[model samples]
Target chain A: MILAVAWRNIWRNKTRSLVILIAICLGLASGIFYMAFYKGMVVQRINTAIKTEASHIQVHHKEYLNNPDKKFVISNTDSTVQIIRSNEHVKAISSRVIINTMAQSAKTGTGVKITGINPEDEKQVTNLSTKLIEGTYFEEVKRNPIVIGEELANKLNVKLKSKVVVTLQDMQGNLTGAAFKVEGIFRTSNTAFDKASVFVRKSDISRIMQLDNQASHEIAILLDNNENLASTNTSLTEELSTLDVKTWREIMPEVSLVESSFGITMFVFIGIILLALLFGIINTMLMAVLERKKELGMLMAVGLNKTRVFTMILLETVMLSLVGGLFGIALGWLLTFYFGYQGIDLGTWSTAYESMGFDTLVYTQLPFYVSMQIALMVIVTGIIAAIYPATKALKLKPAEAIRIDL
Target chain B: MNVIEVKDLKKVYNSTEVKVNALNGIDLTIEKGEFTAIVGPSGSGKTTFLNMLGGLDSPTSGDINIGGTEIGKLSSSKLIDFRLQNIGFVFQAYNLIPVLTALENVEFIMQMQGVDKKQRQQRAKDLLIQVGLGDRINSRPSKLSGGQQQRVAVARALASKPTFVLADEPTANLDSKSTENLLSMMEELNKQEKITFIFSTHDQRVVNKAHRVITLEDGKIISDDRKNE
Candidate 1:
């Protein structure tokens, strides 16, 4: 009966109830959609970090990362690669001869880090082959074929089939120069990575620098699934204690920070929205309680206890909030679904977004648990908002309330 | 047997600068199966005295023993339970829960008593029938007229099977015909069911129908008349 009374009581002032209901609905809907949008952007950035920039894990000579000197190469790379390949989680691995050098085009010259890789092995480790804006992946140009980024190509004033001279100091402290024709121009989301990096055939660079073909500076590994990244990284780290083995998270801490701090950011964002809606709910419920002052007094006079009275008010407020919350969740889900499928194109700001390693076209994504958490938060907010008004209702003196003119 | 016993019942309102005596040294007793009226002009303490009798308010100095229980000694929570079990009230404005149907309004009191649903429903229906609101049981209070709403209030008051019903100006908003109808119904219920009724009113019609009439002035009982005596 109390439940029934509370349910019916909310409809007493339809306009007032609906005003607050709509306020909660719109507030939570926007909050939920914004959460989904941010999650999508972060997930995309993480995916790009792993697939394009850093494979699930990377292995390098202990001092090669600290000092990218060509002399700090990992010896006996074949035996180390064989040991890592035996791990069940290992999907693909590519050894690279990393050389920080200068490349000179006919029009200009700029500093560049040349990644020397086996084309076939690199295909499985990185998605650079698929990111080609023009030309083939080390296929069309047969002699000293190189892949450069669109940003780097623009900087060098080079186009497909353009011959660029790479100048570098070899392992013997001698200046070496080689001519390479651009076989591919790839454009990744990270403009900085695009501008500073170029890839060449590992055999070509190793032979030119008089280095042993079996020795390389870095080994990049891609796992079958990122969930296996930790176990595989630990296994490889223990097996190859002589080399530095680091997962993508350790390799890119900024991206890792964004992924880990997403929950707190969401909490603060939705908290602000619910905090605003909380006062609106309180004001509405207080008015409802005040409007029904005489009725409440009569209820007490007729032997309705204070706890029951308080519960009735609480129930009314919760029902109102839950109804609005459910609607908000539904609306938010619908918008997320629509935008997630079609994608929200930030084409106008694509340059800025891409410069920061974010895809311009984002597909909104939220885990099922996140929506459940938001629903729970809404219920908690409703309970908190009900407190003051319900307490006020409990304070009404039955004798005086019954006699109240209104 | 007496259902309510009072001794030196007094109520004082303490303001910033004045202490106004609402109920001054009053004494009264009401027996079972009696229909009584407490009448007075405004500020004569008729409402305050009724409030004390109903356990809705505490007297500054008094012993109100209703059915072997000293109400003033009970905690606020226990006092509410005492009222639920022993007293029923019908306000002057016919304060039915506006959202509930007439049947629900009547059943609500029994619900508070934790009565079985089927039994309460049947009793609510029967009570509404007795109060001449049988056909309008499904109508909410707003849909009912002032007189009809009052009838529902009376049915609601009787639904708890309380020791006595306290009516504070129950007929003050009713027309003559509705007043006469309501009085006739109360008179029949008092005679037939032995349900005690205590009313605080300025209505002469109610005073004329009561078996006993107690009038107050300046917070003191000025007259006590009994037609049966």
Candidate 2:
């Protein structure tokens, strides 16, 4: 009966109740949608980091990462590649001869990290070949073909088929330079990576530096699925014990941090939104309790106990909150579904977003469990908001309240 | 048999600078099945006496024994239970829960007493019918007239089957016809069911209908008149 009465009481002032309900609804919907948006952006960045920048895992000469000197090379790279290819989870692997050098164009010069890779092998490990905005991937030029980033091309004042000179130190620590024609200009989301890195044929760089073709400074591996990353990384670490093997997470800790701390960030964001809505609920319930002081007094005088009175008020607040919360969740879910499929284009701010390695077009993503958790949070907020008003109702003296005239 | 016995009932209101005695040294007893009225002017403590008798307020120094149990000695919670079990109240404003229908308003007290659903529902229906509100059972208080709302209040007060009903100017807001109808209905219930009724009223209509009248002046009972005796 108390439950019935509590439910009816909410509609006593339909306008008042709906005002608070809408406040709660819109508040939660915005919070949930914002959370989904941010999660989508972060997930996209991590995906880009793995697929386009750093493959699932990488192996290097134990000291090559700490000191990028050409002397620190993984000897017998052909045998290492063969051993890695034996793993069922390994989708593709590529060996790279890396050197920190300068690329001088006809107009200007800039520092760059030149990566020498077998075009076919590198194509399987990274999606750079697919990101070509200009020429073919090492097809047009017969010798010393290079694929440079759009940002690097802009900075070096060079275009497709432009001859650029790469200055570097050889394996014997002697100054060496070579001319390579830009075969392709690729543009990735990460502007910084695009500006600083360039790729060329591994044989051409090895022949020029008088280095052995069987030695490599870095070995990149791509897995069929991210779920196999840990297992494949561990297996490769054990098999290639003499080399330094690391996953993408260990390679890019900043991106890993964004992925790992997303839950806490969302929780805090939603918490603030709920906290603001808490006061609105409290005020609405307080008005309801105060307005019915005389009626409540009559109930007490007629034998309704304090516990039942408190329970009635609590139930009213919770029911109100739950109704609005469910609607908000439904609305948020609908919005997420629509945008997740069609994607939200942040084209206006694409430059800022792309500079930080985030795709401008983001597809909202929120797991089912996250929406469930938000529902639970709404219930908890209702309970907390009910306490003060319910307690105030409990403090009314039946003798005085009954005669309060209003 | 005496249903309520009061010995030297005294209630003093102590404020920061004043000590106004609301009830001063009253002694009285109400018999079973009696229709009595406690009448007085404003601030004469008639409401205070009724509040104390209903166990809604505590006395400064007194003993109020209702049906062999001393109400003053009960704790706040136990006093509430005691009121639920032994007393009924009807206020002037017809303070029914506006959200509930007339029938639900009547059944609410019985529900609070943990009465089973079917039994309480049936009794609530019977009580509403007895109050001449059988047709308005499904009407909320806001939809009913002032007199009809008071009738619902009376039905609710009687649903508990309390030892006695305390009515504080129940007809104060009613028209002459409604007042007469309500007083006659109460007289009939008192005569038929032998249910005791104690009222604090300023209306002469209620005073004329009572079998006994107790008048107060300056927080003291100045006259106790019995009509039939």
Candidate 3:
């Protein structure tokens, strides 16, 4: 019966009840949505860098660490790749050869850093073939050609089928050169990479760089799970004595740091909302006690123990908080899921977002556990706010309480 | 035997500037099942007297023995238990909880007293009916009149079947007609249930109708008198 009375008391004043409820709801929504988006974006950042750029690990010549420009210095990359492919945990591998050169066009000239790769094997490690914009991949024509970055292509004033001379020094300090047609154009996630980098056939690199008997300077390794990247990198480092193995984080420190910073920022954001809601709920309960001072005092006079009065007020607070929190969680979850599905692309926000190193389309996705845990946190926060108000109500003097007119 | 005994009852509130003695050693006694009234002007310690007897307030220096227990010396929690089991109170403002219905309000004290479900419902229903509020069982305090609300409070006071009802100017907010009706109902309950009714009031009509009247002024009793039945 006391519980019934307590429940009824909370709803007697509609406006007060609503004010408290909205406070709790807003708090829960802000916390839940921020957590969901922050967690999702962090995972997305790691995966994108791992699968589309760094791969799980990259194996480079021990000499490459000191001077990566060393040519014709590969130590049978094919046998090493075969050894890695035999491992069940290994996902894919691509051999990469890069040469710093200058390209001259009819209208313009610019310095270019060209990466030589086997299109078939490269797709396995980096999935870059799909990033091609104009013309087909060079593999489709069975011809050795160069794929230029957007910035390089713009500077050279070249389009599909444009021709350019790639000039550079080969091994043994020999000056050598190559000519190739532009077969395709591609964009990198970060525009800096697109501005300076170019792609070429791996066989052509061996022929021009005078390494016909060797492969590229490094090999990129990928795994189905980016979570395993660090462990795999460790294992490879232990097994390979002549080469250095680097994980995605070590290869891309700046990007990984952003992920960590984003995570901490999210936690702080939610903490502020949670703290405000807790106090809001506590304030509402205190107001309730003040408003009903006379009645509470009378209850004591009529043989109600102090414990019962305290319990009634606490229960009232919990009911108000939890119900409000649930409503807010629903709204936040709906919004999170809707945005997660269709994703708010940064396309229109391109100029601004590009500076932040993200693509035009920024997709959003959240882990199921993240959203569920946030809802549970809402309930806990509500319970915490119930304490002080209950204690104050219990300490009321029965005589003075009954004396109050209202 | 007297159901209540008060001797040399004194309470002093020591503030920063001075001590305000609310009660200056009141001496009184009431026999079992008696209907008594304590009358006093404002600031004359009528409320202090009631609080001391109900175990809701402690006397600074006094002896209050009610039903064989020295209530004035009990701890706050023990006093609460004692009040729940032995004393019922009615306040000047009716003090009906606005959110509870008449039935729920009446059932509240019984719940605190640890009465079982069926017993609480049956006893509350009986008391509300005795107070002539049977039809308004589902009505909250806001939906009831001053007299009706006071009657519900009275029913709540009696729910635990306490040995006595301590009413502190319970009719202060009621209309004359409602006050008359309330006093008559309380009188009927006192006669039928043989439970004591102790009221502190300044209303002349209330004291005139009482079987015993204790009048006070300036924290001291001026007269203690009883009337023939």
How would you encode candidate 2's per-residue C-alpha lDDT over B1-229 as one tens digit per residue? 9999999999999875789999999999999999999999999999999999999999999899999999999999999999999998889994798889999998889988989999999999999999999999999999999889888988888999999999999999999999999999999999999989999999999999999999998889999999983
**Per-residue error (Å), model 1, residue B149:** 1.9
Kindly provide the TM-score obtained by chain B of candidate 3 when compared with the true chain B: 0.96
- Candidate 3 displacement at residue B79 in angstroms: 2.7
In candidate 1, clashing pairs total 0
lDDT of each: 0.91, 0.92, 0.78
Question: Per-residue alpha-carbon lDDT of model 1 for B97-156, expressed as tens digits?
Answer: 888899999999998999999999999999999998889999999999888998898898
Candidate 3 iRMS, in Å?
A: 1.6
- Report the lDDT tens digits of candidate 1 across residue range A1-406: 9999999988888998899989889998999999899999999999999889988999999997788788888889899899989999999999999888899999999999899999999999989999999999988777899999999999999999999999987779899899999999999988989999999999999988999999999899999999998888888899999899999999899999999999999999989999999999999999998878888888988899988998898889889988899899888888899999999999999889999999999999888898888888888888999999999989999888877777
lDDT of candidate model 2 versus the reference: 0.92
DockQ of 3: 0.59
Error of 3 at A329 (Å): 2.7
Better of 1 and 2 by TM-score: 1
Span of 10 residues, lowest total lDDT, candidate 1 chain B: B86-95
Considering summed lDDT, which 10 consecutive residues are worst modelled in model 3 chain B? B91-100
C-alpha lDDT of residue A202 in model 3 = 84
Per-residue lDDT tens digits for candidate 2, residues A1-406, read 8999999999999999999999989988888899889989998998899888889999999998788888989989999999999999999999999988899999999999989999999999999999999999988899899999999999999998899998888888889899999999999988989999999999999988888999899999999999898999898999999999999999999999999998899899989999999999999999999988988888888777888888999999999998888889888888989999999999999889999999999999898999899999999999999999999989999988898977
- List DockQ, one per candidate, in order: 0.76, 0.69, 0.59
| Cα deviation of B75, candidate 2, in Å | 1.3
